[model samples]
Target: MVTTSIPTTTKSWTVLGTDGFDSLKFSKDTPLPAVSDYEVLVKFHAASLNYRDLIIPKGQYPFAQKPGIVPGSDGAGEVVAVGNKVTLFKPGAKVVTLFNQGHLGGSLNPQTSATGLGGVIDGTLRQYGTFNENGLVDMPASLNWQEASTLSCAALTAWNALYGLNKLQPGQTVLTQGTGGVSIFAAQFAIAAGATVISTTSSAEKGELLKKLGVDHVINYNETPDWGAKAKELTPKGEGVDHIVEVGGPTTMEQSLNAIKIDGTITIIGFLGGVQGEKQPGFLDALVRMCTVRGVLVGNRVQFEEMNRAIEANKIKPVVDPKVFSLEDAKSAYQYMWDRKHFGKLTIKIE
Candidate 1:
C-alpha cells in the first residue's frame, strides 16, 4: 500500500440543529481527524441519501444525535491514507462505509445499536472522514462512485429484507412499495433472482421507471387506493405475493397484510408514511394469515459483502437521480428528496 500526505481540513455539510433542511450548512473547512492504527482516511467522492436523512434533521430518528454533526451513512471513495494496522484497505483502494461499524457478522445488540452513523455519530456526508477498518468494505469494480455509494444503506437493507434470513426462490413474487432506493433495489434484486416483482409508486412516470427495471407490475397507489387487493389479483393464480418490502410503516402495513400470502414474509424497513394512518391493521390479521414481519435496520457487513458480489455478477447499477448536487448545495438536495420528486437515489458529489 502506498502512502500520501494527510490533509489538515476538508469540506463538509454539517447539521447545526434539528430545524429541518435549512439547518444543514456547508462547512468550508472542517478539521479532519487523524487516522489511528485501525483506521483509514477516506476521500469521499460521492454520497447517497435515504429516508432517514430527511427525518434526522427534524430530530425524529430513534437514535441520539448531536448538533453540528456530519449527517450521512452512504458514500464511496478512495482510500488516500491507511494506518499501519489497517490491512483490509490501503491507499488508492475504493471503499464504502458500513452504517453500523460494530455489527459486522453477528446478531444485533446494544453495542452495534450504538454505532449507527449519521444518527449515533458523525457520518459520511463529507470529503474526508476516518473510519475503523472493520466498518469499510470494498466497492464493486463494476460500479462507479455514485452507483457504489447507494449500497451502504438502502441497497443493503433491501438485500437483508429479501435474502438475509428468508431467501426468495425462483418464480416467487415480491411486492415493493414506492420508488425509493430500497424498493427499487428490492425490485432489481428480486428480478435478478428470478422472482416476479410487483411495485407501487405515486405516479405513472415513476411506475414506468420501475417497469423498465424489470418490475412485472407497477400499481399506482394514487390510482389504485386498494393496491393490496390489486397486488393479490396480479400474483400467480390469484395467490398473494410471497414477500413484501414494507417501507411505509403504519400507513401501508394494513394493505401489506392484505396482499401477502399465508406464511409469507413482510420486512418492515421504514416509516415513510409516518407513524400512523387512518386504519391500522390488527395483530389478529397477521396471526390468522401466518405472516412473518421482520424489521430491517440496513444490514450487517457480511450481508453487505454478499450484496456487492451479487451486484458485480449481475452488473447491477443503482438508479441515481441525474441532477448532481455539490456539498455546498446539500440543503437543496435534502429539500429535493423531501419534495418526493426523485425516482431513485439522490446523490451528492464531493470534490
Candidate 2:
C-alpha cells in the first residue's frame, strides 16, 4: 500500500454539548490526526443517518462518547493515503469503513485502545477521517458514493442478521418491523434471498410501496394494532413467520413472539418502536418453544464484504429516500429523521 503525509489541519464538524444539541458545528481549522502504521486516511464524500445517530445526542447510547463528539457511523469515500502495514487497499480506491471499528473479521470485542471514528473517536462527518485499514472494504463496482455510504451500518446489520446468523432460505417466511434503515434493508434483503417477506409500516403509502417491491404481505400496524395475528394469518396454517427482523424492542416483542413460527429466529437490533418498556408476555415461553432471540450490533469487515458480494450478484438496490441537505443542513436532516418523516434512508452530502 502507498502512504501519504497527513495534513497538519483538516475541516470537520464537532458537537459541543448534549444540552439542546441541534446542529453539527463546523470547524474548518481542526487539526487532523497523524496516521498510524495500521491506519489510512479517507476523504469522505457521503454519509448516511441511522436512528442511533439521533439517540446519541439525547444521551441514550451509553457506549457513545460525550456530547462534543462527531455523530455519524455510515459513510463511503476515496482512500487518499495508507499506513505502512496496510495491504488490503491502496490509495485512490473507493472504499467504506465498517461501522464497528473494533469488530473486524466478525469478531466481537471492545477496542484494545481508543480508536473509534465519529462517536468514541473523530468520525467521518468531517471532510477527512483516519481509520485502521482492516476496517475498509472495497466499494462494489455497481454502487455510487451515496449508495455505498448506506451500507456500513444498516444494510450490513440486516445482511448479517438475516443471512449470517439466521441463514434465511428461499421460500421461508420473514417478518420486518417498521420502515427504518435496518428494517427497510431487511425487507429488501429477504425478498432478494427468495424468502417471502412480510413488512410492517405505520403509513399506508409506505405499505403500498413495500407491496410493489414484491413483499408478500404488509401489515399496517397503525391500522391493525394486533398485527401479529394478521402475520399468522398470512403464513401457512397460521403457523407464524419463520424469521423476524425485529427493531421494535419491548413495544412489539410480545407480538413478534406471537407472529413467529415454532423454532423461529428473532433478531433484535434496534429500539425504534420504543426504547425501554416492561418485558412482554410469553417472551420466555417463546424461547421455550425453541424460538431464538439474538441482539445484533452492526456487522464487521467480513460480513460487509459478503454483503457487497450479494448486492453485486443479485443487483439489489437500496431504498434510499435521501433528503438532500448541505453539510450546514445537518440539523434539519436529524430533525427530519427524529420526526420519522422520511420513508427510507436519510443522508447528507458533504460538499
Q: Which candidate is the best by TM-score?
A: 1
- lDDT tens per residue, model 1, 206-288: 87888888889999999999999999999888879999999999999999998999889999999999997999887888998
**How does model 2 score by TM-score?**
0.93
Q: What TM-score would every model get versus the actual structure?
A: 0.97, 0.93
- RMSD over all Cα atoms, model 2: 2.2
Q: At residue 245, what lDDT does model 2 achieve?
A: 87
Report the error of model 2 at residue 15, Å: 2.6
- Which regions of candidate 2 are displaced past 4 Å? 1-6, 64-67, 111-116
Q: Please report how far candidate 2 places residue 132 from its true position, in Å.
A: 0.9
Candidate 2 lDDT over residue span 267-318, tens digit each: 8888776766676655566666578888877777788888999999989887
Give lDDT: candidate 1, residue 299: 88
